[model samples]
Target: MAIPQLKDKQVLITGAASGIGRAAALAFARQGAHIIASDLRLEPLQSLQQEVQALGVNCLLQAVDVSDEAAMAAFAAWVHEQVGAPDVLFNNAGIAYLGKFLDSGLEQWQRVLNVNLMGVVHGCYHFIPLMLAAGGPRQVVNVSSTASYAPSPSMASYAASKFAVAGFCDVLRMELAGTRIGVTDVCPGVINTAITASGAAPSMQGEQLQRLQAYYRKEGCLPEVVANDVVQAVITGKTLVLTGPYSRLLYHLKRLSRRLLFKITLGTAAKVGYL
Candidate 1:
């Protein structure tokens, strides 16, 4: 398929308050696309709206909790009323959990699964039907993580959620193959974002936490880089996109030897004080 032109297209992005979502909203807006940016926080969404509109393109900001089925449904309705349907839907809202699965509890699992996994499910369930009805050609981008392939020992729930996202996108992509809508599973490695800081549990305050944060800061790629890649992938109708070099490497490593990869990942997590 030929690359789709984004000019004047409607793009919907969740978790647009920060990180890759924020970067994507700006990137698409710069390409002359109308942006519907949604996030959990109103203040940040408002700030994002200003930045997006500054690009001289239309931007609609909504405070949405993507984990809520009812809220997502309402958001879909609102989008239908305001912009009809998005030419591109980016289901990017997610949370991170950074601790051993044993140290975590049921609440952590529920929260992580709800936001990181079910959030994508809700977005697709509510938005795809609308997109199909409004579409000639459109796209859906589901944000997974490098953890989808190479999960750190300390981040069990997070890894599980991302794995589910990747699997779900795989199925969705096959189902939508004959249609004009394309599904992309985006697996991003560490990107400089507040997710780590926000996910830091109360019990995790100390030198170990600082070290982990430093590692991400020193090695993580910029969110804008991922955003640019996502835009290009959408134009080319890519089915899977690994954002950072590390993410791509991890994917290949796991494929080569799952057992050896697991040991290596566990060892590295322990050395980094993540386990």
Candidate 2:
């Protein structure tokens, strides 16, 4: 069911060129929401804009790196000038790092955290004030990962970044308690997306990367599945959304017993040859 309130609303989404962001853009467009899409790549953003415009909703495209605080601030200023405060802000830009803690370098960790954790911070810092000043109902969606709850062996940096994102959203939610604004932390399990292909895994060889991508393609859910959940989260003001296969189960398992969940995660990763 479409949310009637979403019609003519403005939505800003980062990492909108592909994967979950692209799917979410189309999903929101289907709901009659205009899109403000940003990505580091202009060509894909243009392609996404074309498809979004075909959905009969306007799409404004920008090439901005979410990891850059100054760039995000400038983009936020531009957005305010163009459409005031957006009704929805989706901080969905992130990168993946797949390597054991000892194998990964400090630079790799920094890069991952810059994009995954600090990116969310920049988005909330620059945009939330706009939403508050506008003084109406609004939603902020931060894309964390199931890794936040169920950590895997070779994804130390990725898990750390997502954990931070989840924690940040929790506190942000509390701080915005009395306002009309709502914060939702979206935790997605493996989904068939380019993230695996684009991720930095220094210890993995080309063949291993190919195998990982194949595994995701064969076992992961579609990005549209998560996209639908994101829209629903916004409509219902859900505080947390766990989507994709095993995401909710793992979340519950972690809550039930952290030690058992850790064991299960290690066994699963080994069985899949990810460790």
Candidate 3:
């Protein structure tokens, strides 16, 4: 199929203040897409708005906590009043937790799950109906992670939330079959982002946290790489997108041999002190 044109389109992106969300905002702006960038931080959101406007495209910044259902509903209502339905909705707001399940408390799980999973839920619950009602070519891209399929030992909360996101996207995709809207699950592996620096759980501290941050700085792919793939997925209507080599490899390994993949993952988890 011919790639869908993005010029003059409206794109809604969550967590647009930084990381993959920031990269995607700039990328879509370059394509002449009007950006609706939402995030929890007002200052960063303002900075992003300026950058997007510098690209000569319209950008509207909404400061919102994505985990709050009522707040998302309000945001969605505001969008309808100001911009009508978005042509593309990118559910990219998420948080990370970096400890074993046993070490973590209910509050940690609730916090991570609220942001990583319920945030996506709120975005979809509010925006998807509008997309369908508008009756045009629309796209929903839910940002998951390689951990959705490639399970690690200590990051149970993070993995579980991503897994839920992937599964939700799959079911939504099937439900939207034969419609103008397409649902895509975007799985990004290690990407160089401030998420590890700022969003890591308290349980990861001192040497372990430093080591984890160092590894990502040395080896993680750029967020722009994932942003580009996300754009492609929307244009080409991809159902599942794996952004990095490791993500693809691990996904295939899981498909080929679940048992072997589990054993290998366990060994790596041990070496990384994730056990």
| Top-lDDT candidate index | 2
lDDT of 3 by residue, 114-211 (tens): 99999999999999999899887899889999999996876888889999999999898888887888888999988889887655555667787787
Query: Which 10 consecutive residues of model 1 have the lowest summed lDDT?
Result: 197-206
lDDT of 2 by residue, 60-136 (tens): 98899999999999999999999999899999999887766787678888899999999999999999999999976
Q: Which portions of model 3 show Cα errors greater than 4 Å?
A: 1-3, 198-203
TM-score of 3: 0.96
Clashing residue pairs, backbone N/CA/C < 3 A, model 1: none
Poorest 10 consecutive residues by lDDT, candidate 2: 197-206
Clashes of each: 0, 0, 0
lDDT per residue as tens, model 1, 63-160: 89999999999999999999898889999999888876666676888999999999999999999999898765899999998988887877888889
The per-residue C-alpha lDDT of model 3 at residue 97 equals 80
Q: TM-score per candidate, in order?
A: 0.96, 0.96, 0.96
